[model samples]
Target: MALLSVHNLSQSFGGLQALTDFNMEIGGYDLVGLIGPNGAGKTTVFNLVSGFYTPTRGAIVFNGKPTRGMKPHEVTALGLARTFQNIRLWNDLSVLDNIRIAQYHRLGYGFLDAVLRTARYARAEKNVDRKCRDILDMMDLTEFVEELPKNLPYGLQRRVELARALSTKPRLLLLDEPAAGLNALDVDGLIHLIRWIYNEFKISIWMIEHQMKVVMTLCQRLMVMDFGKTIADGAPGEIQNNPDVIAAYLGDGAV
Candidate 1:
């Protein structure tokens, strides 16, 4: 079965339609890219899928369960996790604390257990700490565990966000503009890191990225949108040559 399936999805704000009939099916270990011009509603699709915004029409089925009317945390609990276009790390918290907090939704301890400091709470907290440490180590972020997110370089902050998302143990990872502020070397490193994450975890990844080099290098398939509508979907090479996609990014004259 598909890991994620969206059918006839649409979203609107006031009089502006941000997305129209956006349909997608992501398989169990797929690495897909979504790309378009600035206002093409790429992030809008991610928002809808991640439950940040309720869709005006249609349905989303993730891991064989309907996600309609679910809150963002609810969707996250259903094995979906995402990073933002702009980094959303807790700047004031230590990197370890940030990663530790992402696992609270699954900590398996209730308020009473925590208030009384029960054995269950203790075990859960210990497990979370170990898992957070392991994740940071895996992401090459162990050395910065005690550092604040705001103190890290932009590229390392991006890694910390990625690590936090992975701490949720998501079946499908959504990365939004992960290479946004990176220099050329950092972008290259991001490509390798994303590839490594996909291979290591054997999970699906769906990314919305503006950088052509990042998408072309890391994505197995590419979906292009424009003016709240899908214009093209195909393999990376085909999308690179598609007249509709080329026209959307460049202009009709270029196509």
Candidate 2:
């Protein structure tokens, strides 16, 4: 089944057109790449899907539900989660705390229960901790659980972000520039990590990235955007050979 669909999606910022006639169909557990030049509106599309922006016009259906006007938290509750282009970790919090916070949406407790620390709330909190630890293990973050974000290396910090995102138990995960500051080896680690995420969790992934090495190798399908419009969409091999994508990159001097 199609986990997400976008048709004729268009957005504008006053006089600047950001996205136009964007259409895509993402199936279950698909590893899809959204890419293009620097100003290609890749992150904008992620925002639109995650409810950061209401489209000027279009339809976005996630898991057969309309996403129009829903808030970001609402999108997450509906089994959609995303990471930012910039790492937004709580620098002071331990890595375990980061993932534990993401699971709060699924916790079964009223405000009064939290305030009073009821027995039920205690049990719920314990379960959340166990689940968070399991997620940390999956991301290879167990060793750093007690450490704050500031103490971790850049590459490990990125994995912590993914671990936190996975704590949400999302069916579809949107990753924006997950490999942003990594060196070659770190990027390769992310490629394997992402593939493992898809295979083990059965989660569909859609990502926006400028790193061709990771995007081209990791994603099964690729979508090219230029000037906020999708210019080409196909498999990795086809996209690498496509003249339009090549020209779009070179024309924008991104090559």
Candidate 3:
């Protein structure tokens, strides 16, 4: 069975339909890319799947369970985690705390235990600290673990956001425009890290991106959207030659 299934998902904002009859299926360990022009509703798909917006007329199934009314945090707890187009880290928080906070859902300690400083709570805290540091090391951000996000470079901040998303321990990782503000070198590094994480962690990745190079190089399958609908979907090479996709993007002057 597919890990994620979106059947005829649709969304609207005061009569402007953002997405219409959208459908997709993602398998385990897959790297899928969603791409299109600026207003093609690419991010809308991510928002719907991540539970930021309730769909207007469709259903989503994650890990064989229905996700109609689940809240964003609820969806996240169900093994779905996402990063935003714009970095959304706590500017005042250290990188360590930023990643640690996302692991709260998995911490098996009660509030009372935390307040009373019980042994179990102490163990959990130690585990969290160790895990957060380990993840920071993996992302090559251990040196910046004590620094605020705003104090880091743009690329490092993006990595920190990705680290926080990974801290959730998701089966499915959704990234929205992760390369938006990156330079060429940073984008190359981002691509390398994405592939490394997908392989090392063995997690499925679904991404919304405007960077064609990243999309073509990393994604095993590609889905293109335009005017609130899927224009084409296939392997990267096939999608590159798709006439509808070429026309939709070029006509919009997006390419």
Candidate 4:
């Protein structure tokens, strides 16, 4: 079975339909890209899959279980994590704390344990701190670990968000527009970092990206959506040459 599967997924915000009969399957360790014009429901798909918003129709199955009404934290506990299109880091918090907070489910100690400062709580806290620090080191944000995210450079802020997502030790990662607001050099660095993450974690990555260069370089398979429907799904080379994709999203100039 695929690591993640969406069968006839649909979402509606009042009268406006944001997604319609969307279907996708992501296998273990797969890197899949979802791309389209603005308002094409790419983010909606991420939101639905990650349980930020329950679908209006159909079903999402992750690791052989249904995700019909699971909350965001519940989904995270099930080993799925995601970053946002907009940087969603806690601006006022230190970078280390931000990453540590994402590990709440892993701590496995209750408030009573925290109040008593039991050995389990102590051990869990130390383990979480060490893991967060290691993740910061990997992302090269160790120097800014004690600094607020708002004080960091844009690219580094992005890294913090990605690090926080990874702190959960997810089996599947959803990255929404990781290339947004990045310059040429930063984008190149992001591509390399994403590749490194894939190699290291061996987890499935489903990303929504507007930057064609990032998508073509990073994704093994590409799915194109427009007006709440999929226009194409194929290998990057095939997607780039697809007639429907050219007409709907990648213009003739893209070829």
Candidate 5:
């Protein structure tokens, strides 16, 4: 079964139609790329699916349920997670604390149970800590456990953001420009880490990116949009040869 589906999604900001009839289907374990010129509504689509914004019109189905008016955390509870193009982190918190927060719900006990530290509460806390540390290690951030978010370098900061997102235990991950502002080496590391996560967790990924090299390497299928509409969709190789894609990039005078 598909993990996520969006049909006839349309949204507008008064005079600006941000997305128009956007449609997609993502099956479990599929890694798809969403690439297009600036203002292509790629991130807007992510926002709609992630519940950051309610669409002006259309329907979104996730895990076989309607998601037209769900909240962001509600979406996360339904097995969807995402990272923003612009980094969002608790700068005052340690890297570990930031990531550890995501697993709080999995700890199971209510506040009273936690304060009491009953057997169930203790066990749940222990399990959460173990899993959080394991995820940190997976992101190659084991040594930075005690370091504040601001203490980490830019590349590591991005890694921390990714780690925080993964802690949500999502079935479908929407990554918005994950490689943005990353150096060459950091870009390579992100590529490896993302693939490993997909392999280890069996989660599907949908990303909005402009980096063709990374997109082509990480995704099996690619979708391109322009002016809030679907312009092209195909395999990486096919997308490269697509006339619409070429025109969309060139026609917009982007390249």
Candidate 6:
């Protein structure tokens, strides 16, 4: 079975129709890209699939279960985690603390256990600390564990956010514009890091990226969206040559 499946997905913001009849299926370890011009509803699709917004019409099935009414945290608990287009780190929290907080949903101990400092709470906290450190180390942010996210460089902050998402131990990772503010050097590093993560974790990755270099380098398949609808879906090479995708990005006159 596919890891995730969406059927007839649609969303509207009152009078503005954001997405229409969107459909996609991701296999167990696929790496796919979603691309298009601005306002093409790429992030909207991510928001709906990640449970940040409920779809106006459609069904989302993840790991063989329906996620129609699930909350964002509930979705994360079901092995789906995501990083936002904008960095959403707790600026005041230490890097380690930020990573630690993402695992709160799986603490496996009640408030009473925490208030009383019971064995369960102690064990849970220990495991969380170990996991957070491991993730930080894996992402090469171990030295900055005690530093605040606001104090780090833009690229490091992005890595911290990605590490926080990985701390959730998701089977599918959704990355929205990860290379948005990165410099050329940082973008190169990000491409390498993403490729490493995909191979190392052996998990499915679905990303919305506008950087042609990033998407073309890492994605095996690409889907193009324009004005809330999919215009093309095929291999990256095919997408690059597709007339509809070309027209959507460069004007009909260019086509």
Better of 4 and 5 by lDDT: 4
- Candidate 6 positional error at 201, Å: 0.8
Residue pairs clashing, model 3? none
Q: Where does candidate 3 stray beyond 4 Å?
A: 252-255
Model 5, 1-255: lDDT tens digits are 778989999999999999999999999889999999999899999999999999999999999889988888888888898988988888999888898887765667897887887998888878888888889988889999999989778888888888998998899999999999998888898898889988998999999988887899999999999999999998999999888899888874654
Task: Estimate candidate 6's alpha-carbon lDDT, on a 0 to 1 scale.
Answer: 0.96
lDDT of each: 0.95, 0.90, 0.93, 0.93, 0.90, 0.96
Question: TM-score order of candidates, best first?
Answer: 6, 1, 3, 4, 2, 5
Per-model root-mean-square deviation over C-alphas: 0.7, 1.8, 1.6, 1.7, 1.7, 0.6
Residue 237 in candidate 1 has what lDDT?
A: 98
> Which digits, one per residue and each the tens of the lDDT, describe model 3 over residues 90-151?
99999999999999888999989989999999999999999998899999999998899999
Residue 66 deviation, candidate 3, in Å?
Answer: 1.0
Q: Which scores better on lDDT, 1 or 5?
A: 1
Between candidates 3 and 5, name the one with more favorable TM-score: 3
What tens digits encode model 4's per-residue C-alpha lDDT throughout 204-235?
99999999999999999999999999989999
Itemize residue pairs with steric clashes in candidate 2: none
TM-score of 3: 0.97
Span of ten consecutive residues with least summed lDDT in model 2: 246-255
| Number of backbone collisions per candidate | 0, 0, 0, 0, 0, 0
lDDT of 6 by residue, 1-255 (tens): 999999999999999999999999999999999999999999999999999999999999998989999999999999999999999999999999999999988999998998999999999999998898789888999999999999999999999999999999999999999999999999999999999999999999999999999999999999999999999999999999999998999899996
Comparing 2 with 6 on TM-score, the higher-scoring candidate is 6
Error of 5 at 76 (Å): 0.4
**Model 5 TM-score relative to the real fold:** 0.95
